[model samples]
Target: MSFEFVGKFLPYFNDGLIITLMISACVVLIGTLLGTLIALAKLSKIHVLRWLANIYIEIFRGTPMLVQIMIGFQLLGKIPLPEFQLGILTEDLSRLVPGIIVLSMNSGAYVAEIVRGGINAVPKGQTEAAYSLGIRPTATMFKVILPQAIRNILPALGNEFVTIIKDSSLLATIGVMELYNGAQTTSSTTYQSLSPWLLVAVYYFVVTFITSRLINLLEKKLGKGYTK
Candidate 1:
């Protein structure tokens, strides 16, 4: 409610926002790459691969992300990793690395399903046509199938990115200093609980809203040349 209060802490929030974006970006990159591989594994002819992928998807999807982050923090702490600075972010690799890994694994489970559904939605005839043209299965999947599947899943991927932006807040529990953590810091410093949280809520809404609109535009552009 106090514009002055909000203005005073804007820099703190901005710093947190930068960390939030960094975490989200890293998670999206790792998750999408991991998820694509999992999706392919799930669709593979090898039962062992499919089974392992299913188990992975199930375990991650079935658990709370908060729990996963906690577990990751504990487990990854045992590994001795060299710490380094990355711009404005923390130099402590322990929290940062584990938080990103946990979130990426969690995101990958959901993204795998999204990608699998998208791939499944593609007409079976496309694969058959590729096969008839003497294209190998790998070529058909990578060259023909995945391109169409990615187009179909673009909107869903956009939603996932937005989800990551919001979900990155969970890293605050591990002291990664993202938006939610920023809100906590501001709240404690200003001794105004409601306003700090409210500001971050507004920040989240703005970021997610703009992201969604950009995704909608992208979907429209991509949908232009293709039918269905």
Candidate 2:
């Protein structure tokens, strides 16, 4: 394997890689926050809220993320959405925003289910005890139920984050041009015997491995107090 192309291709993708990392981070953070909300809604005592959350989970999880990205950024932008005029977002936000939105929407579905499972795994007595102690329903959820639920679901959440990291490659299809895009461009320009592709693969592997390790630590910490 000729290693000379490393110097040639790496610089070209350096900026793009930064953008990719930024995009992935945004997707994870935004997705997790939104997902937690949806999860709570799905587990709500109100049937209406549960139904709404279920439908949302079904639609996003059932749809292809690629289709979502294309429709969200290109088609929807052309059609002019009318709900909110949040003013123009930034250059980075343009491609990255839609990508993040689509991914967060998609990931939220699975996350909701994971969170629900975590909630179920929590001892039912805990909720009852919170109620007996005069904790409001909302307070019980935020302070007692959800916190424990989140601890249980940390592993699943990490797995989803890893999935999102890999799935971020889909953004390139819409011209977001992330790490994979940078690799493609470099490979085409240099005709560089697969080195660029290999490098991109290595980068993903390392990042994912580190993420998995961190998640492992979280799971261990949670496991100390919980069963799953």
RMSD of each: 1.8, 4.8
lDDT of 2 by residue, 10-115 (tens): 7546666666677778888888888888988988889999999999999888888888888888744454333321122113445556777888888878888888
Q: Write the per-residue lDDT of candidate 1 for residues 124-217, one digit (tens) a residue.
A: 9999999999999999999999999988899899999999999988888877767888789878887885888888999999999999999999
Error of model 1, residue 84, in angstroms: 6.2
Q: List the residue pairs that clash in candidate 1.
A: none
| TM-scores for every candidate against the unseen true structure | 0.93, 0.87
Q: Which runs of model 2 end up more than 4 angstroms from their true locations?
A: 76-92, 225-228
Quote the positional error of residue 60 for candidate 2 in Å.
1.1
lDDT of 2 at 107: 83
Top candidate on TM-score is 1
Off by over 4 Å in 1: 1-3, 78-91
User: What TM value does model 1 have?
Assistant: 0.93
